[model samples]
Target chain A: MTTFAPGRKASSSRRHPRRGEELTFWIFLAPFFVGLLIFTLLPIAWSAVLSLFDAQATVYPTIFVGLRNYIDIVTDPDFLNSIGTFLVFTVFIVPVTLVCSLGLALLVNRLPHGAGFFRTVIFLPTACSYVVASLIWKLGLFNGLESSLANQVLALFGQQPIYSWLNQFPLFWILLVTVRLWLQIGFYMLLFSAALQRVPEQLYEAASIDGVRSSWRMFWSITWPQLRSTTSAVILLLMIAAFQAFDEFYNLVGAGPTARPPLVYLYNRAFTQQDFGHGSAGALVLTLIMVVVALLQNRFFGFGAADDDSPRKRASRKKVAA
Target chain B: MPGIGSTQISRRQMAGILGLGAVTPLVLAACSGPGASTGGGGSHPTLSQWYHQYGEAGTEQAAKKYAASYKDATVNVNWVAGDYASKLNTRLLAGSGVDVFENNAINIADARAGKYADMTSIIEPIKDQFSETALYNVQIDGKYWGIPMIIDPQAFYYNKAMFSDAGLEVPTTMEAFYECVAKLSSGGKKGIFLSNTDGGAGFSSTMAWATGTDIIASDNKTNGFSGDVDALAETYSWFRKIQQNGFGLQGQPSDWWDITPFANRKIGIQWGGMWSMPQAVKALGDDVGMFPMPPSGSNGTYALIGSNWNQQVAQKSPNRKAALEFAKWLWVDQKQDQEDWALSYGFHIPPLKAVAASASKLQSGAAKEFVDAFTKYGKATGPYYTNEIGQAMEDAGTNIIVKGADAKTQLAAAAKKIDASLATLQ
Candidate 1:
């Protein structure tokens, strides 16, 4: 074993000079820092300031009403309804997406041939623009006319024609969930497939040698435990994506009252009603909810935790040796 | 390794390249401004005229042609494609290069906030030549803020062959209208097509007028539908029946704005605007006939008459005078252009009374019937009927008609919301 004298090595390297290394470090970081300041930080600060004012008529706020906008948004029935609608959408879509994507990934991973073609075909819908996909679903497939594809298939089965899938209650939810599933399933499936590929062949072989004859037992013992990190990441991403759903809902249902999500509600308040202050407050509240949820998820999953054999743990172990 | 002098020279060149890269975007951004010129090359003050994209063919070319013909100023017509209202509002707030633009309804708050210029001086001289309803919403605080461009009167257009086959005459009462719908809906054909997306929002104005209720009070502060809740509820129940009985086309390929369903014989009757006359004529020939929404209560038959487009000069425009003069020259002084704009491309009634009367298109067939119906029963909305109030009513209508909510409860809720909005206006 080689001994690591990390303190002496650090002291020697700090005492020495490298030509142009410091300049290169800053040169690479400058662009990213500039962009962060300009695009992300500035807008966040400005929106925070705007949330404290009353800007109903003009672009700039003329009256300062501290926390009143926030109070109003929390009390507003339409805003609350939008939140309820989004939560319902999330509860339905997140688990369905997880199960469907995982199933697809497992099926594809088990295939020995034509796997690439299957993956590509399944992934094709992800490449389509949300607006174009929504229009195709609305005008071509679910159009309530007797000649639409859905109705035509139903007609063959002797089923009566049902009109206005978007206006109907549970069917509207199904429509939204189906379109979103078609768009997002391929990406999550690819993630799970990559994670599945990383599991060692020896783990499955060892479990089988120990009399684990069933595939279910092998998966539970050898496959699932190995995919903990990826599963956590996938669930977190799906939750966040479910919260920020705007394009599909906007293009499908439009600004109708029945299916208004929070983002659409905020958009109408800001652009349609010209109430920027309340809209900004609503955005801030949504951001806070997202951050809290992310924090709770991180707390439960312990994402980015250093493994015993990781480089970070190794470096700390060497420091302890010093 | 390179020599010191050569290395220094290379470093200087590198610095110069990076500097250029950093400054290029700034220079380009400075060169590019909002509402940058798309067409006009003249030295005259180019007055930018913005218009929402008209679906009718040749409307854009006609607008540009009219602009090019104006000798007083170089007019650059900007045909905004999608979400014209939102874009226009944003630009107005930015106080950009919009010298003039078109909107169907002028928001009084925007006008009061000084976003639009007063066109009273130009409109007052020939105001009498325009119909009273044409100038109704344009005048704010007894001053005209916009020039009326064209009038689109919406009425019922029925398939003549289908009506005759059903052995039905034109409906003169609400009960008879339902009976006619049921008769026409036989054999897989929908009886009527209102709007696919928002249920019956397109026909709510006409329905209210037919029921002898002004949705908005003349005082512009109180709700008018509250006075006759039973009658209004009855009308909404009719809409619900149309949907529940499948008498109305629910999800067609196109919205009610297009005459495709009517033209394709998928729907027997359509509550469509006069703008679809050309398309209907092209598809159905003489099989189309038009009539106003018949009397529901003691009210007489009525058609919804509203401005198709109104031209208004921006308040912050540098060339306000030039813009106003061009608007007057196009919409008011040049009577032939008004007639051409109304009849040539899409068949709208000219806002100017004489121009509409003189147009040969308005003299015969279904077009003549539409004109007659409009003349006898065109009911205009109040000046205070803003988009917010309109949206509230539309939501209530959707609730009552599509969702089968309690009509009285929804209307009461809508009235409360509308009163709150009006209070803000006050």
Candidate 2:
């Protein structure tokens, strides 16, 4: 203001010119930070404390139980069984989602037109609430009624309706898997499609010139390498989601002993039984396992890295190592 | 991204003040309730009441109608939906907003947490008016915690036409009942529908009790399967036989509580409630008949479960006296509302002795039959038997009946789990 530089921009001439912008930025973001602190961070911190107390029906605790809650949850056979359920879900959903989503992406990319329409159609299911979808699955589609879509398939083969596919053992898994796949596959497919679109065509042309005639070979040599990071992310997300599955399982099957995942188990323990102490402990255990899993994923896939680990970067890293 | 601060200050400041001024009155007023007293000035207190969304139509309006009749306070009836138990319990624990609520079961843990007010004082005066049996469910540790509203007995409502077509009598024994079911199931028609998902969930304690085993023994702490373990196993085995052979409606659209499955002709025999009889009779005409969960042997142990819903006031209510007074006025003092609530909307037995005696709808036909069976065999678990225990019982029953698990093993494990749950209460 006293003597403005002639060559420089007005903002650049002053030291720390963004001080006003910074304050304004904070003013805009302050409400969100306050909300996050109150809602999420505070509750998480409180849960950690609640896990150490003899919190029964009330969240407010009077007695300190130390590691007793943890001991009880760990030794509890039901908690262990829930882990098995989570593992079974992870095994079913992860790789299958990865392959199926990738396949859909490739097929849609090859389409001459209407790619957006197809993508929108597939992604629409992702917008559906889990509770609504679960009720429909439980009462409408997979319900044991003769008019149900599941029984209609059996009817097509000139057979009577199958028994409640929900309560039965092996058949129950089919309902769980199919409903989950239908809900999530479309969204993952979009992610893959976006990644596929970003992929460079030069690699494919090089592969073709190198006498790689088969599409399968080209995919393995070029498309496969390009899509590795996206595949890892999808796998990581699917695994995390499988662990967090509560709304669908709780709504559809309820707290079925053999079918309950860890979150559902924790919910029953916390909310149903009103043993918030044990439930909090079980929840922390699940959170720890998930954190460990995410860390492992980061180690294996270089996920969540600041810079993108694109194929060219990996090749450059290999060159540097050489 | 330009801030309002980039503009002149006077207009923005004035706008801010105007906005706050406009919102202040709106924020302060919460008296626009469904059944708020019109004549009462702003000096009167407002009491918040809660009720789970009842399946029957006009229930919410009837509740609000009853609330509107109360001139003492502005009573707001919050018709809660989806997981009402959890919401009510959480609110009660938080010691805010909730004043009065309706619930069928009270967990001992909640009782310890001071979620429920001790209604012994209110109920002690009118103790003789309520049905003696209905009093047992809400009584905890020799104290009444809730005011009984409706005595809902869940029984099997069957198509009388199908019964006559198959020449079947209402079986007195479980074995005979199985035979009747097998005979009725033919030509793609199902014999029974338990709303298999949760059908017979409440009767878990009854299963043990059927074999002279109390789920909670007289000692009040231990599971009571030690005496008749083998008998309980046989009962489970017989149920497995019934569930597998008969074209049992596995997973109907509606559960045992709802009348739709039985009324829709989906099953010949449906494990439905007495409230469903009017609808069933209307749908299936005079062709509907009723029976209890039949006795296994001559031991006189029929698993005729008598469950009820009750109105309770919160201990931490801001105006506890007013809330309790309103609850008493509606459920206890007002006999007409209780009678109307029970009989008009759905066929439930009036918990009040005077109302039940005077209500002519329950005197004859299927309603009379239901009353007679309930009188003879209707037994309820004590207040100590929480929903969690019931759930574990259902899980164990599912294992034995559907999954083909060994009953002895499953029963033992369930008993152990139940005992552990009881132990935590101590």
Candidate No. with top TM-score: 2
TM-score of chain A of each: 0.88, 0.91
Q: Score the docking of each candidate (DockQ).
A: 0.36, 0.47
Clashing residue pairs in all predictions, respectively, total: 0, 0
Query: Looking at model 1 chain A, which ten-residue stretch has the lowest summed lDDT?
Result: A17-26
Q: Write the per-residue lDDT of candidate 2 for residues A1-322, one digit (tens) a residue.
A: 5976666775563644455566665656886897799889999999999999999887889899999999989998778989999999889888788889899999999999998899899889999988888888888898887889989999999998976676777877887887888899999999899899888998888878888899998888788878878888888899999999988888777786648899988988888878888888998988899999988877667667544574446767999999
- The best candidate by lDDT is 1
**The CA-based lDDT of model 2 is what?**
0.80
Per-residue accuracy of model 1 over B58-88 as CA lDDT, tens digit each: 9899999889999978888989988888888
lDDT of 2 at A99: 88
Model 2 DockQ, alpha carbons vs. true complex:
0.47
Which stretches of candidate 1 lie above 4 Å from their native place? Answer: A1-35, A303-322, B1-43, B297-303
Q: What is the C-alpha RMSD of each candidate to the true structure, in Å?
A: 4.5, 3.6
lDDT, candidates in the order shown: 0.81, 0.80
Q: Interface-residue RMSD per candidate?
A: 4.5, 3.0
